[model samples]
Target chain A: MISNRLFIRLLAFAALVAVIAAIFWSQNPAFLSGGNIRALMRHMSVQGLAALGLTFVIVVRHFDLSFPGVASMGAMTLGWLIASGAPFPAAIAGALAVGLVFGLVNGIAVARFGLPDIVTTIATGGLAVGFSYFYSNGTSISQNFFMSGILDLNDKRIIGLDMPFAILMAAAGVAAVVLHASRVGAGMYATGQNRVSARFAGIATRRLIVLAFALCGTMACLAITLLVASSGAANVTAGGQLLMPAFAAVYLGAALFGRPSVGATLAGTLMMSTMLNGFTLLAIPYYYSDAIVSTVLIAAIAIFDPRLSGLLNFRKAAA
Target chain B: MSALTADIPQRRRGADFLMRYAFFILVAVVFVAFAILRPTFVTPGNIHGMLMSASIAGLMFLGLTWLIAAGEIDVSFMSVAALANMVTAALVQDGQGWALASLGGLGAGVAFGLVNASLVAGLRLPALVITIATGALAASIAAAIGLGTSIALNNTGFVGQVLGLRVGVLPLIAVIVAGLYAVSWFVQERLTFGHYIYAMEQNRAAVVEAGVPVNRMLFMLFVLSGVVSSLAGVLLAANLSSGQPYLGTSYFLDGLTAVLLGGMALKLGKPNVLGTLAATIFLIGLLNGAALLGWTDSQRQIVRGSLLLVGVGLVVFARSRRKT
Candidate 1:
């Protein structure tokens, strides 16, 4: 029962992915080899986890620029704790707690104090990076910390799938169910669509915004855990680089699905990961890859958002 | 009812006075505090150095005020400035004349600014998102232009002399910044365009109804911002005699902090040029004081970040309180 627009968008995205894959395969014969496919899946899952959280925030019409900061904070906290001989479970819990606190800070500043979400989150992100640097003493966390049970979790693959990918799938499934089948999700949509009307209808719009940010924070923590396991060390810049790609993926998903949906986000994340992988295989410079991805992001917004087109037409008529 | 209205204006006047002077008073107090804490802080030489640093940020801050006043934000200016700096430095390194190289850099800025304006004003996309993407794109392009991290400028020419110019202990860059501020003040306070900007801030619909060229104004504002940012970048390269690709990164956050801390309310959408200047000076002083205290770079960042949050929070809370 898919609408024509949705079907076409999906078909277009699929064909685009197919073309990119074929191009990469031609460039490198091992591009789609089983080994490379698994690696790409793992990379996408790690990135997809962060994008999923960001999708919730973006759906509420707020930008959580601090998510990368929260991720870095979580990673640094966990790495420092484990290096300092804390139990693995305690370290994980501590990192999640840090994420929760920062998320709450962002939520309160934006939802309660009425500060602009982007500006507030950007400041908080700086604070989080500061905290990460302070905690790590401006150096990467010791690699000895990676020898713990957390690293084992990364390798606990099922069949040919990575454990992180499995976890990402489960999380995505849960998020899809929560967003599409729950009353709260409906409230979230209502709040995002029209805050004043949602409030008039007795929806706690502020609470929903705060809840979305909190969920984003928790997801950042989860993503950091996998990131630390994969990288085997926590650096101050670990999470900052993830923000651009994560944001691009979320917006790309919103464009494809005609809404901010978890499934669309996963698809966008996988597409982005594949493109990045292809770029690497083709030996494209990092800056060019970034420029290309960002251009794609702008293109997605322009092409998919009908309101933007309407605005363009309005401007033309007025002129 | 007459008496009630009379009392309302009086109360509003009181609040307005407080809003306008609070940050200025804070700047004076902080300056005095720092001077008292470190005698060297009050020295003319140190103060000159601080003002020289503030000049670069102040130039960017000037443009930001206009952009924010138009109810739009351009985070891309910093990257534009950086890219412009790189272009100028690369050209100078290749034995091109400094004036021609500087023009090339400014041209780059105008070009990027036009792109930004098209997306933001023509396409009517969210300024925040558009500017962020443009900033990233500009920075990547700057990096891709064969400037390996930094480019050293040939500084034996007129450009270098202008950069190193001084009147007594005062740097010429500070004089240029002061001139720019005066021009900004004149524009914001006296010009008909300034009136349009204020009107647009108060009510876009009303401004449109009044037949103001809103989109064109925005387009011009961004172009002016781009040009000024390019000027700042050129000066920055001359001052350092090198162009660093990541030069303007810190200024992005610092410029925002300066604007917000200077009492420019996000809700009110009013630009306070003088307040922004004061905030820039105060930030420079704070950094000077931090250096005197021997704080690490991380500590300085932490302080700046916290100060920005508090400043923004206070403004938002104050606005909400006034509403209630």
Candidate 2:
């Protein structure tokens, strides 16, 4: 279903990546080293999962701005449980439980109460972040972090792939099946495209929306759990830094595929992470990556949509 | 009269009264409650500080409320404020006068507004995401200009002193903001442009059919918000005596909360100047009281966040009830 214009845009994106990569490669030959490549892949894992979760939410025409806050909540809840000498498995369950509860709260608020997603999620996100801070007393929790062997998940390999990427791919696999191959997936797409029509056509649009948010929240926690395992610490704000990048990746994916998709989101995440890694290789200032991401997001929005033939001709085309 | 006849109208009257004045009641209750709890809260110094904050916050609210009233949004005001902060401070550091420097800052705000208007109104993209991108870009550009740090300003300029000056119990900035609101109130309550803007929100197609310049109105609202937010940025810079790239996210949260809180009162789920003024007072009082009461950061945030959720929820609830 992807058009020729999308195809050209994808090629143009590839060329842009290559050109940027070539510039970084010239500055530092180590930019293309195996170590860097592996590191970039590792970096992509959490963001990949974030984008994957977001794809489903976007497919249902809902925005979940609360994921980072939910991630923070999950990671901190796990940290709190583990610190109190709870069983490792139980702590993981507790963290996942936090995600599900918050997800459901967000879902009910938006889908059931008919609240606007933007402000409602911001409120939920604030509550999540607040709870996280209250747990850690606004500091990083690391007292029992070392004793918990969950850090092994970061180092261990599964099926010859790094543990994080393996986990990411597995989640992506499930998401792909559910979003593309299942009957519910069809309902979600239709609901997003035209909610009134979908409702008239006998789809449980509200239920599907709540489900998307619930899945999104749970998957965000799963990704953040890996981050905590990899880093051996949980803080109040680490997950927040991922929100904008996750959004950019989702937009890039939508722009590429002409619709939100799990696979395209994964690809978008990988592309963004690679460019970010390249920026790091070039020793650019840290915040510059955000500048690049923001610029790319704007460019993608302006140029990629097939509705507008050119930038300045927007009114004419829209008319 | 029978109990049923009297009680029914009384109950209905009670709700109607609440629907009209709940915001003012809330403001009065919060003010009195805080005054009773914290003796220091009612002091002139603290009151001055609160009013000063409310003034700058009021500017932010004015900008956001205009867009929101028109059924558009600008979440990037914080970023634009940061850019204006940097531009003003950087120009000052380059030995430029304050007037010129402030103009440079406001120009930055205008630039962001124009970009936002073009992307949103002209290209028909979603305002939320477009502004998010532009906000990030503005903040980053501000960071680049400041080398990812704060540039210090002395706050010695006459305008800064005037802004900081106190007229009895009132801060001068509060007077400025109130004057600006008075002007906005005129435009909103008396102007055909204002009616067109609101009509566009309620029914864009009908407005287009009527042959009003809806796109032009949208552009004007965007630019108007941009300029107002930039003004807030300059005022904030004056208060802080510095230009900072690394501003906290609280301003954005606070602005949204105040504006949305205002959505519940005066105009019944619509953004209005009077509702926002009362809401801003309540919001500023809450934060000020929280500080004086020694609440933790998390505690304050939790309360504020809940208020936002509840406020927006009430607005939705009111709308649905009206519909039914």
Local distance difference test values of all predictions, in order: 0.82, 0.82
Question: Individual DockQ of the candidates?
Answer: 0.61, 0.70
* Tens-place lDDT digits, model 1, residues B111-226: 98898888888877778767877888888877877534787655746776875799777888888889889988898879998878778867988998899889999999888888
Q: Which ten residues in a row have the lowest lDDT in candidate 2 chain A?
A: A304-313
Q: Kindly report which residue stretches of model 1 are placed more than 4 angstroms away from their true locations once superposed.
A: A307-319, B1-6, B9-16, B154-156, B264-269
Error of 2 at B120 (Å): 0.6
In candidate 2 the C-alpha lDDT for residue B182 amounts to 92
What does the lDDT read for residue A311 in candidate 1? Answer: 78
Show model 2 residue runs off by greater than 4 Å. Answer: A1-13, A309-319, B1-13
